[model samples]
Target: MTARTARAVDVPVAGGVLRVGVWDAAPDAPTILAVHGVTSSHLAWQLLAEELPGVRIVAPDLRGRGQSNAVAGPAGMAAHADDLAAVCAHLDIAPALVVAHSMGAFVAVVFAHRHPALVRRLLLVDGGLPLSAPADLSPDELVAAILGPTAARLSMRFADTAAYLRFWRDHPAFAADWSPELEDYLVYDLVPVADGGAALRPATSYATTVEDTVDMNTRPTVTEALDDLAVPTVLVTVPRGLQNETPGLYPPAHLAALLARYPAVEHVAWPEFNHYTVVLSRRGAARLAELVTAQLSLSVA
Candidate 1:
């Protein structure tokens, strides 16, 4: 087995630079693009990158999240889609398989729609379809309804990495699944803040999350992309939600309705994994690696 060497690169985008993590393999290794969930960075794919020994994985921090939070302009699915295209061009690794989790899945859809030639197939984990919510909810309630604690954490300021780690360790989604990798991922999400003290805060922007979240559920961008899905797509869903709650992001009945609408998109129901564990845990990474490996064996051209 080869050691996976990971490195970060800053690629120029519209407003600011996009931070990309490249898990390097052999020169001729198969390359695949990865997209992380809302409020997540390229580090979210670390465990999965290790599981794939001979493949190159390129992932970027979407604008308004992680290191790219400095990126100016409104955050939406189309904007993220364009940034991903820019990442591919900057690295010269286009036309690869896309493995995206949560909001990344939605971005992957728009990516495929906006840059069809750059996408081979899409592997959506625990997301991709619109997650319908009550239309009467206020903006705050809407973000809270979909993101749960994930959104609330954005507003919090921590004293340091240890403080942030403690906060995440208490999270139900990561409590029993704690690992060094999980710690590293959590630590990377924090940046120093100036709240009259040495406080640290998550790199994700709450306003940007609100914007992206609303666009994902209620905007025509997702609808238009789904209407014109032109590549091979496989949607893999988990049975649990972010807080280890049952029914996850895509409940069976709701997902069934979505699948019915986009009949060509294949669905794979994976049991015993929560939304975060689907990409955060080691076992989950191995299973997802198997799926990506299978897709690599096929020719999308």
Candidate 2:
């Protein structure tokens, strides 16, 4: 009397192989393509998938991360969007509803813009507008500030999964809430090194960081492309920045400006949640599901 586990499949794409995990529950159910943030993998949504009853969930390990790590770069938002499009095409599914968190939101936004016919709706979890970069800060300073000291502490290997998970949990964002699911996720984020110890697989390298940083700061052409897009869109802005310190990184002003431009888009602000937790926390997951399901219901009406 248990449900079936999600199926994992690999699809060949232009750049590299894509590892897609799919839950083919109901053919008529709205297919949700879940995209994780930077420095994360498909495992980010493992809990969300379990929470959604009969929805078909697809999460791909974006290029340069997870099983697609071997898949070399051009790891910008456009590239990631194209990768999602390719996956959808391979599956022969049209007009999928996309749920993307943080940096992944940028990817979904671009995909919806480029292939409007392919994306039925978009639910952005605490990421929508192009991230802004300080004009005066050098790239190095920015990376150091954002990544913290852990950015440069690239070790050849870890003693064990516990070691790596501890390092990951040590982050300021996750220091307080250490869930079992998070531990499992961090464990899979690494691979066994050649020397018999484990290191971060899909290791987020300096080059990858630089490329992601550049992409995050620059205004995506997709934002302009979606000007006339009629697909249902929602932006769930978090209460804080990535560091969880700033109270208004995803402020009402930011969402208001986007709504002013789009006119048809909907916006919601969750004052209780921070950037990462807005999508990862249990309450955040339920809120996201409610918002997305409501959108689906509206479309049916």
Candidate 3:
């Protein structure tokens, strides 16, 4: 397959400029506005973009993550949703189909809710629905519980890019599925810290992550979005979690109960893939591209 080059464009928003990756297709091709997960960057969508060469893929490194990491502000669903809206307006692609993974799904949910006129359909991959969290848990505890080792790495320093690559090389989730693309994605997260030489750190702001996690789990926006969804929504779930463990982020029983409450959501389960691989791997991206194309067709039909 031919590789599609993504052009980086900085869009001015409320707080600051947002760096977005645009994979252009034919001028008339359908457009997909993609949002990445917490602690992730627009590079996360590279595989998916490659799989859908006929469609225009626009992904933003949402505030506090990726290239938008320098854009300062309080991060939450409302803030992210608003940023996404600005991206649409800046690109003149409002009312576009939105495909989001992990925490990005939560942001998309609130985005679709707050700006119904800007979203035509919603495709949520492994998130959007509220996860089960202990009510007594503090924000820090909640982030730790949900993110586990992923969150812990935010505070870690790597001697160099090789060391950072080694760190992720040992991660159980990507160990088996590691590829050149994954390596590039990991390298993109490394930023030089003030410690004498270079050190690896997640571009994502820790404070913003905490705030968004708390809002996703405890805020009213997510619940309100689910309660009054205005557009067709589909949720694609994987069998494994971030660590490649069984029962995944959303256990079958738990997801079933949540889906029962929001009957409007259409859920599809793809077994044998973990949360990260569900969108990162070649096979997973192929499947996701198929789903996106199908949904886009449905929207127009």
lDDT of each: 0.89, 0.71, 0.89
Model 1 has how many clashing residue pairs? 1
lDDT of 1 by residue, 15-81 (tens): 8899998998788888999999999999898889889988899999999888898999878999999
For every candidate, C-alpha RMSD to the true structure in Å: 1.4, 2.9, 1.1
Candidate 2: regions farther than 4 A off: 1-5, 136-138, 145-157, 194-202, 219-222, 226-228, 251-259
What is the lDDT ranking, best to worst?
A: 3, 1, 2
Model 2 CA lDDT for position 69: 71
Give the Cα-based TM-score of candidate 3 against the true structure: 0.97
Local distance difference test, candidate 1? 0.89
Model 2: which residue pairs collide? none
- Whichever of 1 and 2 has more lDDT, that candidate is 1
Comparison by TM-score, 2 against 3, better one: 3
- Could you tell me the lDDT of residue 286 within candidate 2? 67
* Per-residue lDDT of model 3, residues 1-301, tens digit only: 4587789999997778999999999988889999999989998889998998888999999998888888876889999999998988898986458999999999999998899999889999999999977687999999999998888889988888888888788888886788888888889887877565655677878888899999999879899988989899999999899889887989988999999999999999999689999888887888998999899899789
TM-scores for all candidates: the values are: 0.97, 0.87, 0.97
- Looking at candidate 1, what is the lDDT of residue 255? 87
Between candidates 1 and 2, the TM-score winner: 1
Which portions of model 1 show Cα errors greater than 4 Å?
1-3
